[model samples]
Target: MKSPRVLLCVRQNTLRWDGEPSSLCCSSCCVLRCFDDRAAAARVNQHAHGRGTRTSLVRHGDPRVRLIAAHRSPLTALFSARGLQQITRQQQSPATQRRMRQQVSSEPQGVAEDILHLSAWLARQPHLPPVDDLLLDRFLYNCKYSLSRCKSVLDMYYTVRTAVPEFFKHRDATEDSIRRSCEVTLAAALPRLTPAGHRVFVHRLLDADSRRFDLLAHSRRVFMLVDVLLHTEPVLGAVVVLDLHASTWAHVLRAPPPLLRRLAVCFQDSCPIAIKEIHFVNAPGFIRKFLDIIRPLLKKKLNERVHVHTGGLETVGKSLPLHMLPKEYGGEEKSLKELSDAWQLALERRRDWFKAEELKRVDESLRPGAAPERAQLFGVEGSFQRLAVD
Candidate 1:
């Protein structure tokens, strides 16, 4: 017995899993170049085996290799749902995953190559608008630099802005409603990143009067901050710290299904932001009711990421980056108001960018086929729909 074979998640669409072409790997990696070509498969088998033969098995255990019970052999089994995705992260442990995200790629060559490839692809698409290299890099980073996924998302990214005008339009920071929403609700991007390179976003009501709440406007303001982040921040992902301590039943009632649908579309679908986790701190008595309305709107995977806590921030501190949080929530940073004001100033400074971006949207008429229909995208009940933004 020489040695145990190993399972490799081959990179790109040009070759089968773990072959010579594109030897680099992915967690959600690999696809067969041609399932019908026996010659090609045999060549891959020969290339991997020392004696130029088709091997029946790879190693039984690799933390990177996540397996399922399949009728097919191991070679073909890698083609299962989990193995075929473009984004990796098969069966990695929590600590391992955290370390992976925390480790920023020091090598700029790979990123530079990815940007060039992505930029070329972007140029070929007639319907898509011109995207800056920085924005393209952001998309590439979020997709784990998967060119295929990045291209697919870039299409939807512009399409969503055109489709969901309610959330995307009128994003001017100085406007009275937008400013008023900022005053009543603190939807500020925190100054610090979690140990895993995820930016912390705080959402809460500064005003107890539920009557003052404008869910859409409040949400628009929140989105404005995120727009600033997508272009400026280079974090691996985001961890949302939603403090509902000051909320009431009236606030809960303000979240109607339609508004929730559009809002969900904006957060979950449009932009290329990876939400690592969502922690609801100081959850209220009616948190269940609120979840009941919103949970169904979210994707199954996203629904699993939602966590609710009735206790104080201390409970959340166990998981979230409490040390980086503002003093109001138990941390070393400045108070929440000061942070909110700073973000407000930041948004105001970019006032012209928001104005200019309003002009950019998919000219559906120029699209190759029929424009994406509202009914087809989201049901009649929803003004916006969730795309594969994550």
Candidate 2:
């Protein structure tokens, strides 16, 4: 009697439906109900048929010859124990445990490599000041915080650790050591503010094999560095201003608004970067929240004694909108030239606006809801205009 022909069907990118058999196989006694590929039969016959070619083949089913679906294929299960067992007899032996350990040991170091790569890229920037090792440490500490809070980050940290050198064992080194390494790398590198340069560097760092570990760390560090340098480096001030104008900080502060506000003023009077331009794009709503917290502080006139050494356009642009003040305060908006002219007129009158009753009243106005808001109304408006125009 002639035996029934058998065929095995394979799925391509199709989802395996529930209760539907994901695989097909043929046996000597049973026929496949719905397989697609008959082409495989020739190969199977050539490979497995042992009976005389002339004789009728029996349709007995062989459990070993079952068809495995793509999802269940040995290749698909490459990471499974059965697949790994086929690698080498040595791997099958006790050596497998050691191999696993070796893999585990290198991940943290790999993470370190990614951190170093990012630091190196940032160091190459022309507009940024030379970052010190301590700064890098701060960056790494931020990474650690991210890892502690996010599982995905922890996975990246481990993957990087696995690629590290033998001497840099994760078990042997503490978080502080890695942090120090980060700081050292940053300290050794210089900052560059060219948009083209920064974008290129950012791309490279993110392309790293296990990039996520240091993502938040890098973003926060770069933004903070830029923010600080804006208040300090006069030469790079214009570029930072341009960036603030073109970009927003929305990308970095994915967390709550309160936290974002705290970060904005966390440096406190330590305006390391020149304050020519401030943008809210990177962290949308960040600047407004910052202003809210700072309004009361400004009303206190704490910065009154502080000499804000603003130069260039900022110095020339220091004018408050009069309308921004309440009607009772005799406030009116004035142009840059007008503000400058007003200041000059005040000088001619020998009336120091800084010491005038208006200034004192504004200072005293810092006490209650109505008056306090006015003290800030002037500076906040000024800061916003400067940031916006920059």
Q: Give the range where candidate 2 is weakest over 10 consecutive residues by summed lDDT.
A: 196-205
Task: Please list the Cα RMSD from the true structure of every candidate, rounded to 1 decimal place.
Answer: 14.7, 29.7
Local distance difference test, each candidate: 0.64, 0.26
Candidate with best lDDT: 1
Candidate 1 residue pairs in clash (backbone atoms < 3 Å)? 27-88, 28-88
lDDT of model 1 at position 305: 86
Give the runs in model 1 whose Cα sits over 4 Å from its true position. 1-107, 382-390
Query: Candidate 2 on 151-172: residue-level lDDT in tens?
Result: 2222222222222112112211
Give the local distance difference test score of model 2: 0.26
Tens-digit lDDT string for candidate 1 (345-373): 77787788899988888877877666777
Q: What 10-residue stretch in candidate 1 is worst by lDDT?
A: 65-74
